[model samples]
Target chain A: MTKTRRPNRAEVEPIRVATVMDVPGVIALDEEVTGLLKPAYWRDMFERYGARPGGSRVFLVAESDGRIDGFIIGEVRAWEFGSSPSGWVFAVQVRSRLRVQGLGSRLFEAVCESFRAAGVDRIRTMVAPDNTEIHSFFRSQGMMAGPFIELEMRLD
Target chain B: MRLQKATEIALYAVLELAIDPERQLTAVEIAERYGISTHHLAKVLRDLGRGGLVDSVRGVGGGYRFAGDAKRLTLMDVISLFEDVSADTDELPPQEAGQEIARGLRFVLTELDTQSVATLRSITISTMLKLIVRRPWATIALEPRRPTVRRGR
Candidate 1:
């Protein structure tokens, strides 16, 4: 009789380009993390990142057991806030139970690879100052403070 | 029902077409009017096209126009075109409810999901337009919210 070794969680899921099929899984993960159902927002994101014909955008998902457990979305833009061209990561979500298993890092690196291929040297993302977990994650990814600052006003 | 940003954009794009069924509005013009990303709006327009809610043309001066009967289109229809409207509760893992209160909270969440879908299905696009004139922001279309000309400094 032949015996096969069971794969670990990190080895179980393979990271791949996200498709329309992954949208529901992505939404479910986001809702579990953020407590909001933003399906419309995700649909728009999927179209821009998942369906784009060429460079400048990337959407990646880590799938296992026919379900998405982690995903990242990013795009390249120039001259925003008077800054030069850079890659901006708009969203990242990993299934809660699967954190620290290197799945999220793999997704991040996949998007970063796409950004680098698009000719952008810098990658940026906005995270609330108090979000220590995200801050630490970005820090681990070698992200630092950038030149631009976000400014907003309330008319009400 | 809380709408996704994409759904809201879809509604606006459809509304623009509804207000002028003959004019084929380019995604760029619509995005410019709202100060949103043209790239994103373009994708939304493409989805609307695929959903059979709008038709598109190619080459110079090409754009999109409403393809379906406006009065018959509901907000649910537009939203469903972009997203899966079902709650998809089966996707959620079974939660460990050790206490009665925890189970009650879970029930409330499920009820909220049901109510959200029900409300979205009830409102039609035409009925949503009727709500515009009643809102404070509606003054921009109904009347000149600002003076026609600024007074001499």
Candidate 2:
């Protein structure tokens, strides 16, 4: 008699470029990280940015045993705040159980490589100002605040 | 500030479902645990379902399940399902000398409400559940109440 054991989390598959097929799983993961379920937004992003490769956008996912455990989405933006183009990460999240294993850093670095390939020297991302965890993570990644500041008004 | 009966019920329902995410329990089961009416609980459950916090299944072995990851759900999200915290300037009376004190009172109340909502939003459902199960006496024991001495008159 023999017993089979599941592989350890560290031994799982490495990160790879995401595909159109990974959209559903990616959306599910996003909703898990962010409580809002915006299927239309995810679907549109897949169709417009992630369906094919070699665009200004970069979508990467970490898969293990054919399941996506983490994902990141980034793109190049220009002249938004009267500055040159730079890589802007829109979202990045890892499964709660699989966090702190460098999955987020791996995804971030992969996106940075893509941005480098696209001729951008700097990468940027927006996090809720009070989110100290994300702030520290970004700082650990060598990301610092740029010249711009976010301003908003609650219209309700 | 008192939470409405519906809001209180919704909070318990979410807590019960979050306690065991893998286990799907019906409204009746949750209401029984809390000693509340199942009829009213069903209505609250429907509101939760509509709020995208829980999903329902019909027929045999049917029940409501936590829709998303419980850790992602903040206490604010669950409370919003049963309470309308939407800001409305209409609540303020006409701006006049007679209502000056009333307006100032409303401003203070609104500020308190905003601050409390921010606090609730920062606390996730998972954090609340963990606190609920922790030994309450541990903190009390560490910080024993200081005995007050009466001065001789």
Candidate 3:
């Protein structure tokens, strides 16, 4: 006799975008995998980018067991954050234990699909030189490393 | 949905208090700071006092004290205080019976009534204040920078 397990229906629901309800849960998930950028900063980001016109900035959160396990925040900006030709992967992170099982890919593909629907033609992200693991993650997704490097300075 | 004029004014005024936070400033000063008017500023302050955001003192050396902190103050929280959400619901004009437009309108109005204030407050006083100091995008607006005043000999 041969038997196969049916795939979970809940997994077919697609990655869900962040609602006002998921802010704290998603923030906690982010803290587990990356340096904390402060709750206020995150609140500002989701509010501005999520509610932006044209549905350009999409924030998706993955949940399991009634808790956020990961999130992806991406924006469709033309030249800059809003300028037109591209969408930038502003941030995406998954819980440490859930890393290898496709949650990040689901979140990434969900964001890319949303941006493609928004008419965004290209995707970009600024990755640090030292983060070899994350660099490999992007490469595995068939993303090419461009020649341009991001540089910034704050004048006070 | 647009923020009620009073709510916008109060945000700017209270943020000014957060910046200064020493003593109360006059109605005219607050208005001028935001490029609003004294009459309008006073109206906003009265609303703030009603909402318990700022306390008023009478006479010389009396102005306004921030009854709250910037971190604790969400822009949404402040705007909601001045806005009458229930009263706004009362103002919906009844329309034709066939379409049920009122139901849809009520839904949108309710959403805006809740969402707009919370969104605005999400952008805190600190970011707005920083924008004032570093107006990098001022050039982007398509307005004439200098108006010519003809010199008469």
Candidate 4:
């Protein structure tokens, strides 16, 4: 008889990747994902872009406890990378139950590194003008958050 | 809406993977955890895999694993990794409602890329959580909308 041991929380580190197939997990991240839009849309993006090569897109995921906890979603456009193209982040989301952990940052770094490997030199993310959640992050990183806001209200 | 949907899924998937560092999750497992359709979840997972965010294992004891360390990762990088799924604003099939919303949300993605990695570095998972953990009924000051009673899961 032998005992099988599971890795302790400290010993188990978050896995980052260039891509993974965990739609349900990402879809469940938060309102940012589950409540933000529909599932069909995600399917469309993957079919169109993920299957294409040399387009400068990378999709990263973070997994813990055999579950998808958080993610950062974005892409690369040659025009943004340099004079040619670069990667940019579109959406960043994490599970509400898994907040206060370093999941978002992990996803963020994984995306940037993927771009670097592909020779992409730039990246970006659009944010709510008043989203102070990550305002200091952009300021500190020296990345410019274009002055803009999404004029939106729930269509009653 | 497609753009928003794309990222929303990407973020959640990454979070799922991050929290369960030691476990290897199947698309089905991830989907089940979220209570979404496994078929839909598989599509997103495949897209992420293609974008280089994840690698698929082909065996009884195999499943998806992170290609790198999560903390050193950045949202920009993850987006780029998953960019293929949400890459072009010009290529999506025409939908009036979707187009209208996408035209507006495009700014959000663009801002995401332009912002520096260091910008995200100073920020922590804690802060991101705080920002997004909105309780409009509890903390919102604007004319509050009628609250919907949601039963606990």
**TM-score (all chains, Cα) for each model:** 0.46, 0.48, 0.44, 0.40
Question: Candidate 4: which stretches are off by over 4 Å?
Answer: A1-13, A17-21, A30-37, A49-55, A80-84, A134-142, A145-156, B1-153
DockQ score of candidate 3?
0.01
lDDT of 1 by residue, B20-64 (tens): 677898998999888888888888998999998889988899899
lDDT of every model, 2 decimals: 0.76, 0.77, 0.69, 0.58
Model 2's CAPRI class is incorrect
Q: How does model 1 score by TM-score?
A: 0.46
Candidate 1 backbone clash number: 0
Looking at model 3, the pairs that clash are: A77-A84, A78-A82, A78-A83, A78-A84, A78-A85, A79-A83, B24-B64, B75-B121, B76-B117, B76-B121
Candidate 3 residues B1-46, lDDT tens each? 6668877888888888877667688888788877898898888888
Q: Give the TM-score of candidate 3.
A: 0.44
Two-chain DockQ for each candidate model: 0.01, 0.02, 0.01, 0.06
- Those runs of model 2 whose alpha carbons end farther than 4 Å from true positions after fitting are A1-156, B86-91, B135-138, B146-153
Q: Which residue pairs overlap in candidate 2's backbone?
A: none
* Superposition TM-score, candidate 4 onto the true structure: 0.40
Model 3, residue B34: distance off in Å is 73
Instruction: Give the residue spans of candidate 1 off by over 4 A.
Output: A1-7, A80-82, B1-153
* CAPRI tier for the interface of model 1: incorrect
